[model samples]
Target: MLRRAPRECGSWWWDLDDVTETGLVPALGTAARMAAVLGKHALLEPSSLEWDWFERGRGGLGVHTRLGLMGSRLDDPELAEQARACRPVGHPAAEMSALLVTGPGERLDAEGEPRREPRLVELTVSPDPYGCWAEVAVHHDVWSPCDFGGEPHPAVHANNAPRLAAALRALDALLGVPGEPGEPTYFGVAEGHGLKAPELVDGLGPDLTDLL
Candidate 1:
């Protein structure tokens, strides 16, 4: 089971169990474990045979998961600290090459023409190890033809599924905020706002092009 405690309160937690696993594609169990820490299901019931809790619907799991991974949320009193220590498969740098992509409400879902106006964020963490795990997202719109190539394509299942779910939770928290995004905004926006993109760069102003 995975739980997220607000960094400040150090008491908040999101439970991940079989329910979360059931909803997730098998390939991404570890990522789902990360996601489990991000949300609570409306209804939870332990399977008699499996003997584990089953949660329904992800709700706000996605964004919080990302925030948890980003580590910035640790500063928020409203957010929770991880119930347990998270030793990642490996250490991940806080910043990457470029842009952050906006999902759902941030972008329009058309069947074609992604380049026409641009439709991805920068520096995402792809769930697929074979693919770029950094540029990952679950927002499967028609515009993207899984062009990026990776394990967990927004809709496809992969080993990093749990991680992707956790990332979503972290991201959701940032969206919940009302004012301007603060400091070192790693993600990118498409031309001010008309279109959305992924977070390609870790720090928008830093310009790590040559350094990276």
Candidate 2:
């Protein structure tokens, strides 16, 4: 089952042309826990590997992929063991931009240094363009003022606005935490998977509209 922490990051993300229908995806079965909210309701439960999303640069975008707090939490033994068993998302990566990171939180070096800033992401999962879909906790920090080892995708600041708005909405719906409604990139977007916003009264910080 997919593991989720109630007190952990509250967030969401998705593709450029996708929408709620396409965004409502399956969780990786390997997820030991998960929390989801549809409409005005909330649901937290065990997840499956089938819910995972694949990371494929299609050999150009940028350094793409993710490592959660669960990754370094191996000292706990229980989570480390489970993280090692994570299953591949298996979805076709044929259309992914260079390196796109998904999920919440910020990037860290081996010594736990802030690798770079954060970003609000947007993507189109299919070969054919369409409406928006799905939401992710964090995404590729391409827009940050960091080096992508000299990659080929656009920087994070160049991200589309509509897509970011959609991602924020998705996260708010699932996490059930609204952001401080305001302009785009109010939080600077990137920082790994930053699901919980500090601007929120409940400590979740900001509403999805906060970024609009």
Candidate 3:
């Protein structure tokens, strides 16, 4: 079964039992590289990463943070240091946390120019030594105008949903696992699976009026 994300934006997630690479730092690097392949312009600086954690039990913990990146600098040394810094100390032997990163993605228009604004797409990873999971969130306003009900315009879905699918494909290639598409969020599923168009749903998700 697919897990529901806390937010109602365009979101997809994966719970991987065999994350070849472990540790928060390594996971961040992998996420950044994947973002780069998706044409993300830059990675959110490490210093800007806001992290929080709490103990769940003896040697168990939970972590959560929203990370941002920009300008395609995944290899920046300083950024790496910041990612390491974000790792909590005295953490449990096992933990689960969602790492979110957002930056500019490549989405061209009919004129072959960028159709979406900078930092419109978001990527997430829930990395753990034993296993991990990840998610992606996109604010519809970043693509186009929405109605009071929070449905993106048809043109917006046409342009952005496919981009989300392509990015998910790239991520799957990296993970070596075909991710199961989650329930349709505010936007839609990213798994193209040979379907025509971006295959958007009929109704709006939870009220995102203020978020838009």
Candidate 4:
């Protein structure tokens, strides 16, 4: 089994304010476009949608919902309706917040063999009326130059990093907007299309195995 970091190793963000219209339907449409790019590289195959609810003035109602996609795609018109239908009974004024698109993704094992992992790549999209945005985050070190133990994993990086970079590039092209690297985390930081190389001390990066 692949070891996952307690937090994201790296993440990328896209501001879709100009490219995508503000609304649930438009957000789902954007997700569909993104999923297409990611799926092409076998990064994320969206199978479910999850989100929290919040009222305008009352703030978060602490209610959450998850809808299975089954065989349906993100672009399916009914998906949005299904999501809205899951509204909490008491929170009539509640509205959906950022939607999380999660599913299985492929990663290469130590021997360079492909293995499937659930929620390998997490995608979140905000459908707020004011502005639209999306984020992609990875918790595993497959895209990193070194694993949590500070050990170099050239084979894993070579096998997986390129595919992630390609998907990010494709998403940028498809959305007509470039992706901005998200803030750095303890595990690693995003640099360009991949994780930044750690500053080695005696030819080894920081040992983060304890955190794992």
Q: What are the models' TM-scores?
A: 0.17, 0.21, 0.59, 0.97
Error of 4 at 164 (Å): 0.7
lDDT of 1 at 150: 15
Q: Is candidate 1 or 3 superior in lDDT?
A: 3
Give per-model CA RMSD. 18.8, 18.3, 6.7, 1.0
lDDT of 1: 0.23
Query: Which digits, one per residue and each the tens of the lDDT, describe model 2 over residues 1-212?
Result: 11122221223333433222321221121121112221111121111112223344444333233435433321234533443344334543533321222332223333433332323222112212334333333233232232122222223323422234444455554434443322234333433333222333432323323222
CA deviation > 4 Å runs, candidate 3: 1-6, 40-50, 56-80, 86-96, 106-118, 141-152, 183-212
In the range 1-212, model 4's lDDT, one tens digit per residue, is 67898889999999998887999999999988888889888889999999999999888888888899998989899988888889998878789999999999999876888899998998989889988999999999889888888988888999999989999899889988999999998999999998999999998988988888
List the candidate 1 regions with Cα displacement exceeding 4 Å. Answer: 1-80, 85-105, 109-135, 145-212
CA lDDT of each candidate? 0.23, 0.30, 0.51, 0.90
lDDT of 3 by residue, 29-63 (tens): 76666666566332122222334554445533446
Give the distance in Å from residue 95's predicted Cα in candidate 4 to where it truly belongs.
Answer: 0.6
Task: Identify the superior model by TM-score, candidate 2 or candidate 3.
Answer: 3
Task: Give the best candidate by lDDT.
Answer: 4
Model 3 clash tally, residue pairs: 11
Ranking by TM-score: 4, 3, 2, 1
- Model 1, 28-86: lDDT tens digits are 33332323322231011111100111113322212112222233222232322231122
